[model samples]
Target: MNPTATLVLNNGKSIVIELLPEAAPNTVNSFIFAALNGVYNQHAIERIVSGNWIDMSYSAFHNEKAKYLIPYESQLHPEIEPLPSIAGCVCMGGYDELGLSGCEFFFTLRDCPEHRGVYPVFGRVIEGIDELYRLEKVKTKPITDFPYKNVEINEPIQPEIIRKVEVDLKGFKYDRPIKLPSQVLPKCWAMEYR
Candidate 1:
């Protein structure tokens, strides 16, 4: 039986995601842990970058578990899972930093070739890609609720809520969280804009 998670939205919409355990065991396990533990309930879809991806905020319940970071498990380990960051694929947000609130994640609205090796692609939306589109098109603007005078982050005017996250393993083995070096400093690089 395949590993799957059903995200029941408040609007009565449900999105099902097919997880890849063999390819991203730790990432999948982390997701399962949070979903089954009620971490995703009432969580908001924080941002939807036009024609790019829809980013969701991490549930408050994930604070402690977020300390454990899921390594970038993708094509780099083709023997396990080599799926790319294409449309409908779910990817863990952030880079290089381990324990830095690994709660934010995004769903690709269109093919994301640039994110190929940057994030961990753990699963894909098997059903309700259309529902994701509806969420992606929600009206948004600079988040006035938070203080970010320098950097601008667009947030939905009416947040899309994930009422619940239900996981169905169907007899799949659950792996422990992937433990990695947590105190690694984020690398900084200067990029020249054309």
Candidate 2:
């Protein structure tokens, strides 16, 4: 049986994601580890782009610079086809050089061709899509201070929170991913710009 994860949001809603191990085995395992270990707990949903997607775990990674360091599982093997970025698709977020965020993930709001291969898709939201849509309606504002190069990060004024994460791994083996020393991002550099 395939493993699954349910993200319980503070808004009393849950987003169930069906992890595709065949597509991204390590990504799935690492995500499952983070979810089960409270790495994703009590964090605010920080970034949102209307008609694009919602983001989390970026700011959290910066705040606490160390966590499970996993590779881009979808790209690990040529045979493992990465999922396309479609509505409700979940993916890891970060850059190629600096490396992807250990636990940072996002859900696409629509089919994003520009996002193909940019973010390795590992799973898709199987439930609570409506909840994601509802959360999208929250008021947001872009950071006027930071000079973000790429995608505009319209942060939620009253950020939503991931209250808890529950996973049913179905006994999947999740060996602890390698832990790396804290990285100091270059001046004027952040994951959002990548």
Candidate 3:
């Protein structure tokens, strides 16, 4: 089993990630499910913090809330020690207080000591890191919400899309998560917008 997944972006770039199942099994499984189901296709790069990290919340995937909430894998799983968010390292995005992590994931653009021991690191980019930096440096424009009278921040002027995600199971077959949420986003998240 190659245990590698290639993330194809719209910008004519492809990144190969080496999945770390030993470090975070459930997290890896969840990602595999998403990949196989084409949940990550045509997903926009939602947020990017300059010289820091690039956050990806797939439009379709983010629209529905995650059914299963993986535990704090980094803290709970001793085998998976917390590692600094160095360039190309993939990590899960979640709320610790809620004791849940969802589909939103990001890759570090630079060394991020702040995220150490906080986010669950699942994989590392084995190739095409330059593509990661290209996505990170994308020019962004502030979104003005006239009705709400507030500005939405961090939106890219030219949206960078994750065209598709391909996972090589290496003949390893696994079922999807049992509990699939009706909406991948929680009710609380909707309430925040309201």
Each model's backbone clash number: 0, 0, 6
lDDT of 1 by residue, 38-81 (tens): 76787777667778888775332334444445556642255664
TM-score of the candidate numbered 2?
0.85
Q: TM-score of the candidate numbered 3?
A: 0.79
Instruction: Highest TM-score: give the candidate number.
Output: 2
**lDDT (tens digit, per residue) of candidate 3 on 1-194:** 43888989897789999988776676777778777777688877777777777777523245443334556664457676766678889987765555445466778887778877777677999999888877767798654432223323466888788898988988887655433233344333442342
Q: Superposing all C-alpha atoms, what RMSD in Å does each candidate have to the true structure? A: 6.0, 3.4, 4.2
Worst 10 residues of 2 by lDDT: 60-69
What is the Cα-based TM-score of model 1?
0.79
**What's the lDDT for residue 126 in model 2?**
90
- Give the TM-scores of the predictions, in the order they appear: 0.79, 0.85, 0.79
Q: Model 2, 1-194: lDDT tens per residue?
A: 88889989887889999988787766676677677667788888878887888887455445343343455554456676667788989988765655555677899999987777667788998999998798788899887554546658778898688888898878767665543445654333354553
User: Relative to the true structure, how large is the alpha-carbon lDDT of every model?
Assistant: 0.68, 0.73, 0.69
Task: Identify the runs in model 2 with alpha carbons over 4 angstroms from their true place.
Answer: 61-69, 178-194
